[model samples]
Target: MSKTIRMLNKDDYPQYEAMETGIEFDYIAHIFDRLATGDNHLYGLFLDGRLVSVGGYSIYAGSYAMLGRLRSDLRFKGNGFSTEVVSYILNEVFKLNGIRWVGANTQEHNTSAQRVLEKVGLNPYITLHGALTKDTAALESGAEPWQPVTSLQRKKDWLNQAYIRTGDIFPYECYYPFPASAELFQDEAIKQWSFYENDDKTRFVITKYDQKKYHYLHAVYPWHDLTSQPGLWETIASDYRKLLQQTDDETYIWMDLTKEEAQTLPASHQFELPSPWILYGKEN
Candidate 1:
């Protein structure tokens, strides 16, 4: 029998939840929550009257829509189900609303998902890197303590530099959007740090001290030469260690790096994990 695609309903959540996507545990609730709010549209592909694949798109400002929680049953793999479902979702997104572009992302190493995205016409564009450090022993071994940026002027200066750096590296329109201003950085929960080289501002990192689980070093933006700067990673690790100490409740610090920037770091800092992720997009 041929497969049929249709809008998903609340009753369909249980079956959708049961689908065995390895990352489902992290996203199932998020998908349903968005569905409940009626801000997004979810659809399912039915085979033999049973839901085998599910996907959705969320509308964003600027006529942009993002594909979310695309998954199909493992038993139904290799049947082109994922590609079909994504095509259906993108078609619906363009027809039902005024969406000008649709975007999605998958782990760089997940070739199966990438192929499905490509089949649906969303091209790959950018790469992002992320890592986490627990116990801070590596950072503290041989690095300088990071300096706190208490001055509002310095914070503004760093934000400006970061904006320029972002524009310089990613001139393309579809790169991940960044917060527009320094005021956005004034999150009461996060502490910011700056590492200077020879009295000139060189690099900066932001950390949020979570009371329950771990500290998060959300970003590390460097301005000067990263490769020439010996022990830069160690300095960052050491700084993260100090941030981790501020909260007895947390033991880990997470870091987000760009692929371009990560390549400039020394091998000791380059923990070549999976290639960040590829952002895919298509115009309606």
Candidate 2:
């Protein structure tokens, strides 16, 4: 038996696309595009020159790295191939300069992947409830409209409060937790974080639109005081209603919260709550 792990290039896409990994990778073209632009690094592990496991990581904000797009051939399950590939990718990520933290997100129900992540020295950091809705009319309206926030200091302050509320990790995007720091706000090239706040300045959400990759409205909450704050859900719903009025795309919302906090969502709204996701990570 022989094993090899190395970087995968565009030429390897055919072999990657041919793998029967039992997973639907809709972002194959997106990942390859990023690889071409130097924003992504994909790696594959081979057994006797046969591709068995593959994974990739993306660096951002000049200080954070996110691991994702991991898939192993169904035939190679229970052989520790995922662990091998992940371990190798983790090593490769730290070899690059200026990476302070590395992390990955997985559904809470995926215990096997969790085990592999833990074996590679990553631990569960935070959990987020993924909720989505397409029925814009069901959401509440008439609340104060959301206004774009222009002050970087204000955005940083909001994230700081959320960081303290959620133990230190800031759930900044769909499945990525960033370390609480001021530097993350300084880099707009990695990600252009658009900040918004309600009329009274109590409710805040950070959003970005990527029609090709992320959903039309990708929202991350800055605070989790949902249940305690009156009219919180209504305000958020109003924000969604306003955004949906501009486009017909389905809206997706991610919030770092406990199961109890998630119940604060308005019962009338059409958001479907899926199995919560857990983010696993360790410092580089």
Candidate 3:
């Protein structure tokens, strides 16, 4: 008998939950449930009356929608189930015509999910800051405790190194949306960093963003500069200035500061919400 693809409605969630991991189940139940009853759409694949796969997204104020809670049962693996779900959502979302981008996030370890994303032709444009769970301070909204590290008093080198290996002292969601190899950051131009030594520990990490070339300026932690105590953040800034002086053109620089850092070295530069974001579509 052939497997049947079903238009999974909110009522079909229980069967869907059984086929997914706990996190996957809860995510679908909460997030997608809201979207389904509202303006969003949901779709699923059923084999022998069991829900094997599910996906969907919803649009908010923005022209595009976010793709989330996408999953298929492990037994259903290698069946192009994920590609099917993603394709279904894209087909629906693209029909609107004004949509620009579809955003989605998965754990760095979930290689399967990553392939599904690429197979569906969704571009990977973000290196989301990770969640700080261990050996770090919890961030209260509007609170930036990272000023000390940013200021670089004593342990700047050690912390910088840690950021590359473990992550920031704060925490971030690590990602490699494709099959990665022994060498990471193959395309990054700004691979090297040199640190500045100062008594104040008041330092700034000034990285230039090429609006023309939109890629992340990734930080390599354990800050392995050739010098035992080289100045990196400041050095990068100086280099950045040199490039600007040559080009005689200004570029955008986004600062991801801890609450303390923000309080201490808050940029005089004005900023606004980068962009309003949203998502929508049908899941296979």
Candidate 4:
């Protein structure tokens, strides 16, 4: 028996597509195309010339990368092939220069994959519930105006509040939790940060266009303790509804909130809260 692992090229797509990932998400299904386009770094592990396991990573914000799309041939399960592929990919990635952080996301139910991720030093750092909404009718009547936030250097107090609310983790994208810091807020790629505030200007909402789906709106807001700020939900709902009107009917807004906040969402709102997803990461 012999095994070999190496970076995969576009020609490996057929074998990659043949593997049983058992994941139905559009992003998971289309990974090979992204890899072919140089958007991702993909690697494969072959046993005796047969492709058996695969894993990949994508760089974000020029300072960090995320591992994803790992899968194995269904027939080759139970032999720790997934672990081997992930560890091999991590070793190869770190050998390159200037990657400050690495992260990965997984569903809560994927215990096996979580074990593999942990074994490779990507420990669980944050978890969030995904809430998606498309109903315009649920729009609340009124709320405070959202002032565009171009920077956070002057808002030291607000940044502290955000850290307390989210444990120093900012839900930068739909499911990606990035370190909450003023330096990160300075990145040019994430200029869509905004805030809805009363006199104090403590509340914030950061919105970004989903890279994979043109019609999707990814928004994250760190409101400390929904119990004390029940009225904020109206602002959130109205914000989504107004944005929905500006886009095609198929467009939907996505928010990553705590499980408690998701469960407490007003029934009048049209958001669908799915199971919480876990984010794992390692800083180098």
Candidate 5:
């Protein structure tokens, strides 16, 4: 299918965003407004008069760039449109030098997307099982519960001390991969992190994302992994049950032992989707 692909001018943004928002069934107008005004770059593919595909880079300067909003109209999925969009986006990204790596993920069952990445020369790095959560169960695998917690209820179950109001870098120094991280995301459903120093600190965020399956790790740790040296799986499992008892809400953490580090997780620690989506990229 022949199409004209180009970077959107300021006037084209509203239409581009409209197409995206409609697909998401979401309205983060506030966050989208900031992107429209900021240093990000957006590219669109027009099939005649309609913007049929869209993608962009969220550059965070010296750190990393997040690959985001790579959406194509549902009506165009099987026509091999994504193959062209991914290549065009990479061509533009190669023009910049500071972007260390670009990363993205979809439901594990979305094999079509995996094929697209392979077709475009991007290789799989890691399948982070349970690394995602959603409002409605989007996971094709996992036994994560669907109960959303109330603000008051969260206060009672959460540790007594105040958690820092900032998002800390993940343990491996990975950031949100995009500026949208600045956007406050989803219902009262949020992940709050704090160091629990007390020996009595017992809880686990070891759950997974699955609308209809049990992809959760069935473990929890607050002060354990961060405070002490890496604790063995057996010892951690003992505290995980106590941690699990602390909350009435549903939660899950990453599973699967594809990497040497991940292999340390207990074999008994099961998941609904074990196929890993490797995260890897080259610096631009």
Candidate 6:
């Protein structure tokens, strides 16, 4: 049997939604919304007249387009379908005049997905720590919770502290280099919180919640600031527990930390080992 690749439409959503993938439905919806608004281009692969896989790319600043939401049905496993779909997308990306580079990121534990990416010529480049707080005991420890940093001055102070302590070498935001401007503090997507010591902003944490599947806290910079501070992680853990308690849904909280930062987390906190999420890219 042969496979056919074509642009995906709203009609294909139900079929793609029914298929198993690491991407959550909310994100899937976000992708379709972008597609509808001309913010992204999505493509689907059909086998025997059924949509078995879907993928897409979105143009970003600096002549870059990110490949996202590449997923396939479980029944199609071992057929090299994923690699075929990715290769097709990469070819399409290169055809665009303004796109200079194409890239994607995958969890380190997802070896199967990584294999597909590798087969399509994307390689791993960096490791990021993903930590979760779910253990009942850890959450119930009664430590102090982080308060939201509402004032711009306080937010600026926290960022300045991070910059000074870390020397601005690490990527503060996912794969993109940390912004040199203070405007990062104003992003609506992220909410900033802090654990202060004696009215001084000793520690800070930034997080984004979808109010659905999960809440992701950005990777903390100068993690040593928090780890070295006595009982700070516990305080953060307590706050996390309180957040979980208030939510009736099963939304999980994830914190991205460096390998060293992850290791410093209290053993009571349940989390995955620090692993590298490779950013694979190709120049056009």
Q: How does residue 271 of candidate 5 score in lDDT?
A: 37
* Higher-ranked by TM-score: 2 or 4: 4
What are the lDDT figures for the candidates, one per model? 0.61, 0.71, 0.46, 0.70, 0.46, 0.61
The residue-by-residue lDDT of candidate 3 on 1-284, one tens digit each, is 45666556767867865774546226456655665666576777677787788887665333446676576788778889778877777777777755654556665456677778778876554343221111111111222212223323233444344343542222111221211111222223223322333344543332333332223332222222212223444343344455545554443333333223333322332332222111121222
Against the hidden reference, what TM-scores do the models get? 0.63, 0.82, 0.45, 0.83, 0.49, 0.60
Backbone clashes (count) for model 3: 31
Model 6 spans with C-alpha error above 4 angstroms:
1-4, 13-41, 47-52, 57-66, 73-80, 91-102, 119-121, 134-203, 212-226, 234-246, 270-284
Among all windows of ten consecutive residues in candidate 4, which has the lowest summed lDDT?
136-145
User: For candidate 6, which ten residues in a row score worst on lDDT?
Assistant: 176-185
How much does each candidate deviate from the true structure in C-alpha RMSD? 5.9, 3.4, 15.6, 3.3, 11.2, 5.9
Off by over 4 Å in 3: 4-6, 20-25, 30-32, 130-284
Task: Name the top TM-score candidate.
Answer: 4
lDDT of 5 at 261: 36
Model 5 misses residue 141 by how many Å?
Answer: 31
Tens digits of per-residue lDDT for model 5, 1-284: 55887776567756665564244453323345545446666677888778877766665434455555567777666777777887787777766665545555544577777777677676554444433221212211232222223354453344222222333222221213221222222223234321122233343332222221333332223232322232223333333354457645664443233344345434443434445544534444
Predicted structure 5: lDDT: 0.46
Least accurate stretch of 10 residues (summed lDDT) in model 2?
136-145
Model 4: what TM-score? 0.83
Number of backbone-clashing residue pairs for each candidate, in the order shown: 0, 0, 31, 0, 22, 1
**Candidate 1 residue pairs in clash (backbone atoms < 3 Å):** none
